[model samples]
Target: MDVVLVSRTQAKLDATADEIRAQYPSRRVKCVRADFTDPDTSAVYSHVGRELHGLEVGVLVNNVGLSYPHPEYFLKAAEDRCGDADGGKAAASAGWGPQLFDDMVRCNITSMVNMCRLVMPGMADRKRGCVINIGSTASRIPCPLLTMYGATKKFVEKFSRELNTEYGGKGKHGTNITVQCVMPGYVATKMSKIARTSWLVPSPDTFVKSALQTTGLEPVTTGYFPHTLMVKAIELAESISESMMARTVMNNMLGIRARALRRLAKEQQQREEAQSATATDK
Candidate 1:
């Protein structure tokens, strides 16, 4: 079957399209460049719809998402720095602000809903289609530091299930639309910043293959076996004591946050030192 790939960067899209063509020479591949981070939702979806016009989109993957650069508390994340005219003080105090939250909602939640609306009607008319919404393990547990990101993914899980029920083989025409929410743990990808792969953390291609196998079979899944095990363990922990599980997760995320901040500080210091040396030499 032919494919239509939509993403923010044209160059990446072209490179991916080339790879697909190499694998399947006979199949057609089209690229549509649209950034989901755009606050103007209507215009973005409209452009995507125009680009996809006249094509029978049998499968829709709502995979575009955004997350915090590092885990942080909601209060700090939502701090409005607009009041600080110079912005330097607030920037020194906190690395994130209200705009980051807005972008997360727009990119993670709005994109999925809009894409489903734009593509599903065509599926209804045709009487068959599949949708894969990529969620995260963060949604399955109480993610303390990564609160907003987890909440957005939880939205994905709920929306996909409800939408599946609404359109799955119920109407007079029997529209067999399958909406599957795949809540996966870490995979070796740039987003997760993991270059090496293990049994627990598979490559993106491996994860996709496993996820696709469960399209019609499972409405919601972890997609990979190891990921399922991880969620199951988290569930067991919650069953024992919900508070304990929350605390455990929060502690782990706090450690990650600390390391990220330390790295950022080190980089900044190195830059300043280099600049100082350059000025002295001049």
Candidate 2:
């Protein structure tokens, strides 16, 4: 199948395209550089739509997403304000105020909605297509420090389910379009900051292979067996004591947050020392 790859980095896209071409010499691979984090959602998707105008896109994978640099409380995450000229008053009034939060909404939520809008109509006209939305296990339960990220993923889950029902069969449009949401657990990727692959945390290649197999079979799945087990464990914990489970999750996220902050501080100190050494040499 001909593939269209879109992401923020052109170099990475080119590299991925090369890999695909090496694997399947006959298949055509097109790369489009687009940043989903851009606040101007219309322009971003419009460009994407133009690039894909003639292509019969059989499958659209809404894989682009953004998460917290480190797990943090909703309000606390917005502490930096990210150059809010209003002295953060506007963000404060909105309850949670972070440029990062707005970015996450655009990247995680808006990208999916807009891409579907662009691709689904053609799929309906042809009467066939598949949409794969990557969600997260965090959406299944209450995530305290990772609240906004989880909420955005929850939106993905609900949207995929409802959209699937609308077009997966003979519906209003009389089309068969499958919208599947794959809610995966930890994977060894740059986004997850997971360097090593474990049984519980598969590599991107491994996770994608497994998830691809479940395309039309399952509407909502963890994709990997280990991830499914992880979700089941979370379900068990919720059933036993939701409050306890929440506290456990909060404590885990707090530990992660503390370590991330410590790492950031250390890196900053190292940078300062390097600058000082350079100044001394001068």
Residue 38 in model 1: lDDT: 87
Tens digit per residue, CA lDDT, model 1, 1-282: 999999999999999999999999999999999988888888999999999999999999988888876777777667654213322332333436778888899899999999999999999988899999999988897789788999999999999999888888757746899999999999998888789999999999999999888889899999999999988998998999999998888899988877766666666577789989999999
TM-score of each: 0.92, 0.91
Model 2 agreement with the true structure over 168-268: per-residue lDDT tens digits: 98667658999999999999999899999999999999999999999999999989999898889889989999999988988988888767666665665
What lDDT does candidate 1 reach at residue 182?
95
lDDT of each: 0.86, 0.86
lDDT of 1 at 18: 99
- List per-candidate RMSD values in Å: 3.2, 4.6
lDDT of 2 at 49: 93
Q: State how far residue 83 of model 2 sits from its true place (Å).
A: 15
